[model samples]
Target: MKVLQNYIKATNTHNFEEVRKSLHPNAVYFFSDQTCTTHEEIQAYFENGWSIVQEESYQAKNVNWLYSGSDSATCTYTYFYEGYIDGKTISGRGRATNIFVKESDEWLLIHEHLSPLPK
Candidate 1:
């Protein structure tokens, strides 16, 4: 979905509002480092620590819709993350999965799980 692509872009750019536009009213964002679940908390976290410094390379490995029901869909994808931050090049590869629900015929993200690459 185009909206899903936009969401990914918004996340890479750290565009919180654009990201918010694609989220459900009651959305849950889960980070690998933090084991908490709350919209406001994650929003604050994003505001504080989410940023793409420079030379960031993000490529989607694959996207597959698991179950596309009349009112919802679940999608899973792998992302390759390589970038530079604070004058040091860093690489982070991970898998991201999300659940998108239709609200009044418009898709909105209801849940997300982002897991980091294994060492």
Candidate 2:
């Protein structure tokens, strides 16, 4: 629960630095429209928002969770994301499954896969 909370905070604030803390150095991120294989790439993707966009809301759902050990877990959830670009609201809501691994006593995201919800 606490790890998820920190992840949300890092996302909402667009705090890449904080986000990095929760990400494995070689995390794999498969988004609705793109895939990133490294923390730096993900950071760059979010960094773009600071210059041309703003997040309006981000909501998570499903929340099916499991723990494999003190250092490993898998979380399945849906995310509803809304953002503004050039004053226009763009929304993308989808289901996501993420695998998290604790490294050095810190939970770090190791992999994520996101898919669009059926209309």
Candidate 3:
């Protein structure tokens, strides 16, 4: 949860480095329109958001969670987000599941699946 909390803070502020630190070196990400595996692709996923939005907000709510051993954890939550993009306000009420693994002393994200609610 610490890693995820930092990730949300980093993402809302567009701090890519902190966002990167939250993920494992080989993390996988899935979006409605895309999936990312390599470092370049994952970095691009975060970088690209800067081009489309000058400001954004993200909050996780209504969480259902579980801890599996000392090395693994999983959680599902309502993801609330809004962005200022191209002179318009865009937002989504979504759901996401994030998986994490303990590496040494830090929890790093191993996988994530995010999708928006239907229009």
Against the unseen true structure, what C-alpha lDDT does each candidate score?
0.76, 0.79, 0.83
Error of 3 at 111 (Å): 0.4
lDDT of 1: 0.76
lDDT of 2 by residue, 39-68 (tens): 778888778755566865666777888655
Superposition-based RMSD of candidate 2 using all C-alpha atoms, in angstroms: 2.0
> What digit string (tens of lDDT, one per residue) describes model 3 on residues 47-101?
8876676677888888778665688989988898788887799877888999999
Q: Which of the two candidates, 1 or 3, achieves a greater lDDT against the reference? A: 3
So what's the TM-score on candidate 3? 0.89
Consecutive 10-residue window with the lowest summed lDDT within model 3: 1-10
Q: Cα miss at 44, model 1 (Å)?
A: 2.2
| Residues 1-119, model 1: lDDT tens digits | 66578777877766578777888888887778774366677677776655644656566668888888888888888877777788798876788888988889898888988898667
RMSD of each: 2.4, 2.0, 1.7
Predicted structure with the largest TM-score when compared to the true one:
3
Worst 10 residues of 2 by lDDT: 49-58
User: Between the candidate structures 1 and 3, which one is better when assessed by TM-score?
Assistant: 3
Tell me how candidate 2 scores on lDDT: 0.79
After TM-score superposition, what is the CA distance of residue 56 in candidate 3 from its true location, in Å?
1.1
How far residue 1's Cα lies from its native spot in candidate 1, in Å, is 2.4
Q: Lowest-lDDT window of 10 residues in candidate 1?
A: 48-57
